[model samples]
Target: MTRRHRAGALVLSGMALVLTACGSPAATDTTDAVKAAARQSGDTVYPAQVANCGRTVRVDKAPERIVSFFPSNTELLLRLGLKNRIAGQTWTDQSPPKPAYATDYRKVKVLAPGEIGREALLAARPDFILADGEYQFDGKKLPTIAELAKLGVPVYIDSAFCPKTTGTATLTATTTDLTALGTLLDVQPAARQATAETRERLSAVDKALTGRPATRAAMVQIVDKQLYALAGGLYSDVVRRAGGRNVLDDTVPKGSNFAPLSAEALATKNPDVLIYHYTGAADRAASEKWLRTHLAATAAVRGNRLIAVPAADFSELRAVDGTVTLAKSLHPDAF
Candidate 1:
């Protein structure tokens, strides 16, 4: 299961130091002038407020000490050039910062390898927290947003993971979060540039696939020996944008993105392309072997259309990258 889904089930249980030194009067005056100019230019204003996951979060200034609860959220901050501000981060054994972020990722401290408890989080002394979803603040093993507010810490949950969000809005949700983070972090310019680039790449894929028939695809993963197909959320969105139709999209129930799949159902659906995601090469090989052995009769296996995608791509800022990668695989001539 995806981290989001896992965390949802566990709901019952769960910056850079800006160095400031006393400076000369002239230096202080210059700093004040710069602040005033920034305000006049409509840059990020202090005490910026936004409603996040039903909580009114207010940031008095760009966060200096940040605790990111998930690798995906950490990657978003890295993209925004806020790496130095990240004081700590947490990730599961299966999830790590993407290779592109390896160098910078090593600079930040890991608060824990897996789920962090309330005490560890408090020890980080974070002024702000970037969480994957509201599920992280379950008020059981983790601190609730209300509790954090009393301590002057504002929490920002990725809008894509907000409750009642639909798979169709995945692209919009990510771009929206990017814009909002840019505003809150005083990185509007960088955010705008990133957002534009993301849209441009997606647009290119759409243009290339225009008037073409979508390939029948299914994203499947083995969890505890059970086959689960992606029914909605970012994975489905990636398939849709890549000129492929998710055969299991309609099978997912409301508020969920995955559904159990049986061998009979797999053969019945008979997706033209079978997509599986993994974190490592070994895992990829294992999944591919499993598909070949168990579902050999399916058209996808017979045609050798099994594609392995990095699991991180489906959950992080790399969703666009996933879309492009899948597009190339599904419609090679178009790409």
Candidate 2:
């Protein structure tokens, strides 16, 4: 089965990916984060031992015709140049701008964006399913991991979403996951190469921003007239990695990254940058002009630092893209 994660840090009803940049609670320090990321990814040995949601699965050989659930998994697959192997996909928050593999998406089937469409998933006939976690394989609505295993389709959950708690989701975790996927698909060399490039890109951001003071950021979401601030998880991670700081200091659980806060509090804080995760369904339009009117006295309004990032990019499986996007915005000189 599948769970859509774009409803401002989606919290599902069943076993779900709680360890993501969305509903995750742990905010471990840098050292611990790398250790956890390394433990989960990096070595895709034969009989590749992969674990998820308290269970372990062995991948004896690379899988062909994979049915991926969610845009993170789907996009990661495309980055691996494995588009040909993806039989079908589901749940995208936003389509890629100028999608490089346009033909590849055209060839596959799509399930629902918010929930699993069991019939369509089964019809795709995948040899493997690149799932997010145990919560997604709830078995009742969609095929459980056990059910798929029984049918000879082993589910490969993203280990980044496996741990019950994690420090902050970082480029280290993203590259590790990316590397592991490449290894699982029998392409460690390519994974390593890509990871090296990722390292370089992150380093470039840091180097370009050495002397600049850290930018203070306020991540906000205005959906259905309600005001919420993006708390921890991927949003926090991106801010930290891009050489800025998340200024929405609150007692919100890392699980529910969205926290209801008064407009007065946001205006008082007056962070240097504003990131609004806009959900398209809102009746009233939200935009830069709207932000300026509401936060006229704030630094974000005065500095013109409002940045719009698609919701999916917040706690994304592939985190570097959002980091790079943010780095360019926070410190334009970094790019």
Candidate 3:
């Protein structure tokens, strides 16, 4: 069987073991007691089972020590008021925590500037781990999901980065993830509140732009002079929710998140709005200038409709904020 199939089988087998254990009379009695206590205290039930990626992550209790592998995952935890639970975090050098989370983010231990080595991760004594992508558990440079399971550590991967994920992310999917995290962490109330707030904000955006036409837009990144456009996935969803249509959605292959675009192709599409992502203001200015000089014939350049956004905003948790930002830019009068 292929590697993916093998991994799926392993996950299914592990879930079966979990179900078997929970089925035992002693385990069921304890679980019932815990649930009764939690209900009395108005807390989430114990042993929350969340389907993550292709694995069923069974959390018997809220994790006290969580190692967040990406800024997006870290931010989500912080948003849920679980800053104290984060034992360590990584990948904050290029994209620092959002302004609202800056203080709490600073207090967390920096496991590494980029990917933390397996040794450092284990040293943190993390009871739970949150990763933004499947690439983190590649098993060569880092510990795989099965390996972590063997060590009694449960890992949750963002569905947006799941291997089988395709098309674009939706607000519903985003809230589903938030709800799952909340259940696993025993913070269902907080998660529900956050989800409500997100829906309300997006609903306002939708109400405002109800009859307005969608602006044809394209999100692109310039690296060493080559141009890459966001063709699908979270960014594409952001654009769609923000009263803009991603011009490259139909141009790129299905399930492709990003692809290099030729000057000719970009000029041919001539999107109404061009969003250029960058790490810093200087980089943003440079990218805009490059696009203007290289694809001067495009409507985005000629009409001065170029918008610059931080590259970090394209992440899972931040995509909501990204949508709001893009909507304001695309339909300034609506807001």
lDDT of 1 by residue, 116-220 (tens): 999999999999998877777889998788899889888888776777674444767778878788878878877888899899999999999999999999898
TM-score of each: 0.84, 0.74, 0.85
Give me the runs in candidate 1 sitting further than 4 Å from their true place: 1-42, 166-168
Residues 55-139 of candidate 3: C-alpha lDDT, one tens digit per residue:
9988777899999877767888999999889999988754767899889888989999887888998999999998877787888
Please give the CA lDDT of all the candidate structures.
0.79, 0.66, 0.81
Query: Which residue pairs collide in model 3, if any?
Result: none
The TM-score that candidate 2 achieves is: 0.74
Candidate 3: Cα lDDT at 226: 91
Clashes of 1: 6
Q: Which ten residues in a row have the lowest lDDT in candidate 3?
A: 24-33
Error of 3 at 273 (Å): 0.9
User: For residue 49, what is the lDDT in candidate 2?
Assistant: 55
